[model samples]
Target: MDVDTEINELGISNTVDEIHGAHRIGQFERLKTSHTGRETLKRLGYHLHDTMHATTHEIPDWISRALKAPIPKNMNPTLHYGRRLDRCLNI
Candidate 1:
């Protein structure tokens, strides 16, 4: 049978449609405007991420330490994501 037929006939328990259907539009922008909500998210300039990139290594020591230390919340962002695009997405 074709993929669509297989999905229709045998995919009932897997819920592929429901998996993709849960996303809402403006999901990222959905944060309510509190002092620390959308406004803080928007203000995020990836400062830490930039700082990480400006260093000599592909990844830095402090970031590795983050696993053990939990990158301090007060650290500067120009430092870059101790991550890939996490700063832009969830900073």
Candidate 2:
């Protein structure tokens, strides 16, 4: 699917969709706008986004980590997601 469609379906912010190409949207519940919520979203988003271009070694590591993590019930959008995208890619 296209970025816009994926963004809409995943409930990501338009700003995140703006990152364009090679990205997966991560969402959190709007009601849980606390530190924990943001942190969890960041980790999930980093994992999802990294999948688009992860190297062979990186892919397995990320997948393993994500598989061990719990699925959150909320669906909220945050502005800092993109800002941390680079850090995730570097990991």
Candidate 3:
């Protein structure tokens, strides 16, 4: 949630992370036409895969709605984690 739009020269949204290395899941329609945009996203996937040692398999189309991305979902780890905590507390 701390991410802000910075002036980008190479990729869409031009995020600070893209400047440094990490790319984001930006506008899907734009990425379809932009080579640099695809590179940015591909790089992020490679790095994440290298760190995790697993392929994503395939991103479901529904994931596009989670636009708070690169932040909110990672912060939670999994929805099940939250559910477990709530169950423990009988909430």
Candidate 4:
């Protein structure tokens, strides 16, 4: 696929859709414990509710490994947010 096509496939548009309001950002501050983590997980658990949908969950086993690896303290927020959101889709 060409670069433009790939970018579109990844859902990166030069502009956000005007029909949508502000994008919601989840801060983990409220998820202080595993109980809270599980509660937060519940909100997303529906992503896999339908087996007849033909789409399967894509779990990245490398995430825990990747997150545990060392990294520079100074990281780009854009890349950080991308990986963080990608991980949520799996969990």
What is each predicted model's overall lDDT from 0 to 1? Answer: 0.52, 0.53, 0.53, 0.54
Worst 10 residues of 2 by lDDT: 22-31
Q: Cα lDDT for residue 6, model 2?
A: 86
Task: Order the candidate numbers by TM-score, best to worst.
Answer: 1, 3, 2, 4
Native-structure RMSD, model 1: 20.6
What are the per-residue Cα lDDT tens digits for candidate 3 across 1-91?
Answer: 2234233333457446665553334464355445565566577673323342333466666876664445654465575797778887995
Query: In candidate 4, residue 75 scores what lDDT?
Result: 64
RMSD, one per candidate, in order: 20.6, 24.5, 19.9, 22.2
| lDDT of candidate model 4 versus the reference | 0.54
- Tens digits of per-residue lDDT, candidate 1, 8-90, equal 78756546556555543244334332334544555754122222222244677888777675667756565665654675678
Error of 4 at 51 (Å): 44
Backbone collisions counted per model: 14, 6, 0, 0
Clash pairs, model 3 backbone: none
Residues 17-91 of candidate 2: C-alpha lDDT, one tens digit per residue: 476432432233441345565556666663324433324445677778777655454423354677567767989
| Maximum-lDDT candidate | 4
